[model samples]
Target: MNRRDTILVADDVEINRAVLRSIFEEDYNVLEAENGEQALFLMRQYRDSIAIVLLDLIMPVRDGYEVMEEWQADPSLRGLPVAVITADDSVESEIRVFDLGASDIIGKPFEPHLVRRRIQNIVSLSQRHLDQDDCIREQARKLRESNAAVIDALSSIIEYRSAETGQHIKRIQLFTRVLLEDVAANCPDLGLDESHIAMIVSASSLHDIGKIAIPDAILNKPGRLIAEEFEVMKTHAVKGCEILSRLDRMGDRDYLK
Candidate 1:
């Protein structure tokens, strides 16, 4: 009952357009186009607000196929749902319309109730997909925030057990982000995108986590380490690797790994 969403009806015949309008005008704002060119014009003019297109396959000027071809070619318009309404019920016509990305096809002399139901279904399904995508993106964002919090906590623990401070972890993430962003800009072939950079910057916070396992005497040494103690300090790298190996087993927590 949301009259805000518009339905486009493109047909060369006046009676056909009038009949279709009567069926949908009660629930939706109907935009009528007597030719394909007019239909395309209306679509471009109100692309974002139009919920679904009821296209006639045999319209003049551009025709339905031409309109569909243009729609499919434009990435921005390709996702909008369309339904073909025509007298041509041939299998070839159906296959051609489907191939051109129509969501449904209704033969002419369509039952008013059936036509309305079919168009409603297509719009409803499309809206559901858009809603689901929004939900997924929200969940992913929350997951990323949770992962960052846990990483920061673990890094703080490592700093508490060693000579390092919280600023050290901050500096590591900052410097890693700077370098990765440079790589993304200059080395496009490497395919280092924003998400990749974020994951790597987060992982850098765990670089010295293995120090948590080293003895306090060696980990927080006041002076320079001796050769024997230096060897023990170097083992933190291997220890960090071991700790991370355990994280790999956490299902759907690849960010931790």
Candidate 2:
């Protein structure tokens, strides 16, 4: 991604296009479109590259109004800042541009310094918004990794305390991957995408987690358990649910039970 700012100047009048480019070219990579058709083509090709669009309302072959309409229909293009440059300086013209959701309006003939100032301010603000979104996404990724690590460590501790091998927890994770893959393949109704499947694999260690609390005599005895012992063994699922309920923000607890 080219993070440097780019400005697209779209005008039918060659002189007007040159003037706007001269004002912005020193600070930004400037692109020119002689007509609205060409403007739309450039915008599509370099939507992510461009930060601000300088649009001329009265251009030949699909005017600025139509270009605005096209970009506004698609979410990606809609967020880019658009400054309407118009020969018509009437209050009605400015109001219409505002109604069409332009970032700013410039009237011809423009002072180069004022044009420079407006583009600089708008591009700076747009860059800040993109930076904030990137920060939020990074924070979310770190949080998920931390939570997964805590689950893995705690589950391993549970397995060790029961005189069980770590392989017990490993098998739980492996079986969970199979079940989730089946859900992805055969059950569109479940709506379980890869992210949901990933959480399942991370948290499957908690499925037998409540076995940590059962008496060793009932849990590890080689012989058949009596009715009372079997009933006690059954309680591990409920105990697992109780453990989940005690935890903060573990999402849905029904899966544990």
Candidate 3:
């Protein structure tokens, strides 16, 4: 869909190469090689742009097997799919080509429609992999943005509820984030990234967010809590967990932990 994909056709016969090229040239950028040696050279020269290869088994100098081996050995070329196009339709030929990493096989007297279909399928699959990678990157970006907003909101909630200065929440958040990073580095099993650390620090601010639910008489008391008042104070952790846990906005409980 981006543009007509390029294909390299490797065959010893000039007539076969010409016919194949004529069929594909309308929808593809075509390159031809008379033998395996030329095919490998063209592949290297146009490695980035070429999408697939239509290879023939019998050729002078280097054969198809040797070329396939060379392609598989190179890390850059290893994943490029090759469809073997040869006159040999023997069982041994099919098995050998597949073992050598040919993704597909097309017998000689090449059917134009079948050749077109196989090439399209390989190119489509490659494009799908590219699309999936793009989707993953986009999702990661959105997750980071969501985590940042949650952290800011949690910090605001803490500042609003506490008698301490507004900067108190910000300081505590930074301290918690540093502690989380230290833990993550010292303990690789935690698998914590910067986003996870941010979530944990943000959720830590909400550790006392349930205080908003408590009565002012108990919350703003200047004196130490009596037994009855202490009972009310102990409820904050559970109450905080309940309140934050119910919110669809928060990501996971590890942050609350």
Candidate 4:
């Protein structure tokens, strides 16, 4: 029963607001708005904290439709659960309210228990949705961390096998990051978000990984490679692709592709 799990009751009639507040106040923090404008104001102020809105169709300043329209304009508010309340029991009105994205419509002279149960159901479902989203975000974060670790380990193996300086990989990563930033700024059409940029930077270390298959004598030679030696070096591209193909067969993440 967090104070932030607030239930907003927006109605032009004071008695209805009072009755609704009494029903919800024990389990939730109750907010009363006598007009649509006031309701919208409260909703914006408590957007993150308010769990559900008990909205009235008829109100001064702004109606339920107006408030929902404004709220839905902010993409985050598309999921904000709202229940429309009205004294008019017309089927057309109920259909219109649902079309406006309300969770449910409660006709006036409704049973107190029914109203309470409907609101509790909406709140429970909303909380479950939020919980699921949080879990998914956490799992994605862990997966990214695991992928980075494995990529670094493979890069280190390639660097060691090639007799390359430890600092070589570091410099390549830094250069890749700077170039990615420039591309993001100047070439906006590339549509590269942070995650894509990160993957590219990591994969850059694997560019010369095919060198791992070269002989130690050729790789460690002090002078320029002879024609025969250079030809053998060109095979690194095919070797690297073969390595990646094997890894792909192991069911690696799609980002590796």
Which one is best on TM-score? 4
Stretches of model 1 off by over 4 angstroms after superposition: 1-4, 147-257
**Count of backbone clashes, every candidate in sequence:** 0, 0, 0, 0
Tens digit per residue, CA lDDT, model 1, 109-158: 97999998888899998888777866875676677776667677888898
**Steric clash pairs (candidate 1):** none
lDDT of 4 by residue, 207-248 (tens): 777777988888778899999999998898999887776665
Candidate lDDT values, in order: 0.84, 0.81, 0.78, 0.81
Which is the leading candidate under lDDT? 1
Return whichever of 1 and 2 wins on TM-score.
2
Q: Assess candidate 3 and give its TM-score to the true structure.
A: 0.53
Tell me which of candidates 3 and 4 scores higher on TM-score. Answer: 4
- Each prediction's Cα RMSD? 6.9, 7.5, 9.7, 6.6
lDDT per residue (tens digit) for residues 1-257 in model 3: 22327889999999999988998898889999999999999998887678888888888889999999888877657656799988888899888899998878888797888878887888788767666766765675576467667666765765666677267666787889888889988885555777677656756666677776777788778889899998997887788778777764544334445
The alpha-carbon deviation from the true structure for residue 87 of candidate 4, after best TM-score superposition, in angstroms, is 1.2
Judged by lDDT relative to the true structure, which candidate is superior, 1 or 3? 1
- Which 10 residues in a row give candidate 1 its minimum summed lDDT? 248-257
Displacement of the residue 163 alpha carbon in candidate 2, Å: 22
